[model samples]
Target: KLQMTREEVLHDIAELTSYAKEHYSTVLFSAEDATRSDLNFLIKANQIAVENGATRINIPDTVGTITPNAFGYIVRKNYEALPKNVRIAVHCHNDFGLAVANTIAGFENGASEAQTTIIGLGERAGNASFEETAMSLYALYRIPMNINTRKIFPTAKLIESYCGGKIKIGRLQPLIGQNAFAHESGIHAHGMIKHARVYEPITPELIGIRRSDEVEQIVKQSIKLGKHTGGHALKAKLEDLGIHPTNEQFQKIFNHVKSFGDKGHEVMEEDFLAIVKDVMGELPEEEQYVKIDELTVLTGSVTPTSTVRLKIKNNGDQIEKTASSIGVGPVDASMKAIVKCFEPMSKVKLLEYNIDAITGGTDALGHVSIELMDLETNQIVQSSATHEDIVMSSVLALLKGLNKIMKDKNSKN
Candidate 1:
């Protein structure tokens, strides 16, 4: 299947068509890499196959090398030239992530049938994914497909287990990726809980992935919660126990726990929520901290140096601070500098740092959150961020967590 000559391909299709006709009701002749081979040779070969008994002629763009317009044009031309009795089919690969696009084009142009496999599974990249194809046709192209959208995830899970590997859903992978249904903005989350269409194209549940699972799995996963056990995990725990916090309220509590965890300290729920109210109380009136001006970091030696200059205002009081320090690494040094300037009067100490990337490749962003313990009272603080720069994210997250912790503390009085 990997490599075959024109003669061999023709002979194989002829044999297959004969066998299919005798054994089954109808047959389709699929010439692999039909678009790449000499068109004249393929046309003659297909003609012979159809003459013998092939009910359909399939053209495959094996490498996703053709644009949709070209693909459609070719399929339409081929179908029109071929005998009326023979239907046309299109098979596409996703080498350039345009498999869906090409498939749509083929269908629109002339192909009545699509030869598709799940998740575009094939060699040297993959084939056109059945779920993505179906979703795109139904959702984007307004084409009708018989597939039930809800069956996608279960089908994928089964295939993945049988294949003995994981399906790496790219952050941009439509419909099924972890980030696909994620909403980071508070408004989006609130809207999703009320009605998913506010942010998601289709309710994740429509794909057999329930909202609870999506929330508890993907949302909590993003926050370093769930099985990975970070801030969202605490949030999950709190929610399960019927302890609900408003968006701003939870932000403060979560930041409290993340700060401590980032410093390497694991905490119990009693310790986790004790400082929640205190942190929530310190949040800025508009629910935003000083916008990060910039940070310069130098590390990879005995000691690391990090300098952060921030532009901030409390009420109407504007202030700026530039500080530097040498510590374990850029993240550590950055946090140290931020804590000194941003929360100089606070006594929170980072006890743990945990960072994980949801996906792979050089472009993936690290989702970081941490735990901290106030040196003065042992109260915990935590916070998290998704960023391409882990060190920078870590510093900003720490400051955010500290600010929340102080806010909640001040509010208690």
Candidate 2:
């Protein structure tokens, strides 16, 4: 925006540096957008500043468009234009998400000092993140600095709080993110269980998280369970919850969990506990007299309808029953069809029905919770289920709650 001629620019540099020389002993002369300037003109301007008593020359990637190699070249050209004692510094921005790389490249070339900001906060896309750049030097380059590596996270958090929501550290921010040290994938989690180095480049302990060698301790602290769960990861999770199931029950729980992951839930600890409670709670496998064999629903034009097939065990007899019904919607239709299937054995009334999307998107996880009342015993019970399809979610939740009351009143007796 400063459309000044070459002579005017050189005159300003000389006058400012000279005035600064009279009062200040050390002066840093920064040529803004130096990367886009003519290399020779930039070098001459830097020399003039040095001649006028400036001790440092800074090359700023002012719109942050310069490549790493180009920035390194500019810093090198300027560094050689002055006395060896004149410090060469560089400022980089992350417009292209390469501030850290450009900073390191400048240092590798001739610039010894890099201007950076905390959590990469600054003008426009922000300056280089000091923690990330510094760690890159310490861990990858093996160059030791005066920085306290362990304090990096605490300092980042303090700065994040100071921003007060204006600037927030991203969850995926390297080294400082919540999932930065988390291992969730089944394969990766198993590898981490075997050797921390297998999946992690460096120990998370270096960045403030406590170190743990025991598998249980590590899993509890760093492992997360989700739809991608494997036998190893699930076993670790179960161990963390202090729940021990027989091999058969464990297999059953695992399969149920896999089915529950139809919409890719991370399976929070509470969710895991709930799933375990459902499996180990009363009406365990052998006594599960009613099970949904298959459920299908159709809606949107012709009257919303559903077909439900269930397997029933009545006092040592195995029977299959199918029912079709229509309702106000597909979910309601599915519920009605299920109710019709079980009307002969036990009658129940739905007290409440609630559904919420646990995640985002059209096919995200739909959590269905329902309250049921067994008409025969007048007992009220609550059950919930999750699936990718809303109709299936409603059907599963209804069946779960129905089974709870029916098992207590009609099945055992």
| TM-score for each candidate, following the candidate numbering | 0.55, 0.82
Give each model's whole-structure lDDT.
0.68, 0.83
For model 1 the local lDDT of residue 103 reads 87
Looking at model 2, which ten-residue stretch has the lowest summed lDDT?
274-283
lDDT of 1 at 33: 79
Task: Supply candidate 1's per-residue lDDT for 363.
Answer: 41
lDDT of 1 by residue, 1-413 (tens): 54987677778778878878887767878777777777778788888788778888889997778888888887877877798777998988888877878888888987877878876678667878888778777787787767788889888767767876656545656676666765544444545444546666766777777664345544433223212244434555567556777777676666655554455443333344434433443445654545568788887755788888876555555678787777777787888877766665556778888887534545444567788777766788877654446885587567677666655655564
lDDT of 2 by residue, 331-378 (tens): 888999999999887888999999887655665566778899888878
lDDT of residue 401 for candidate 1 = 74
Candidate 1 lDDT (Cα, whole model)? 0.68
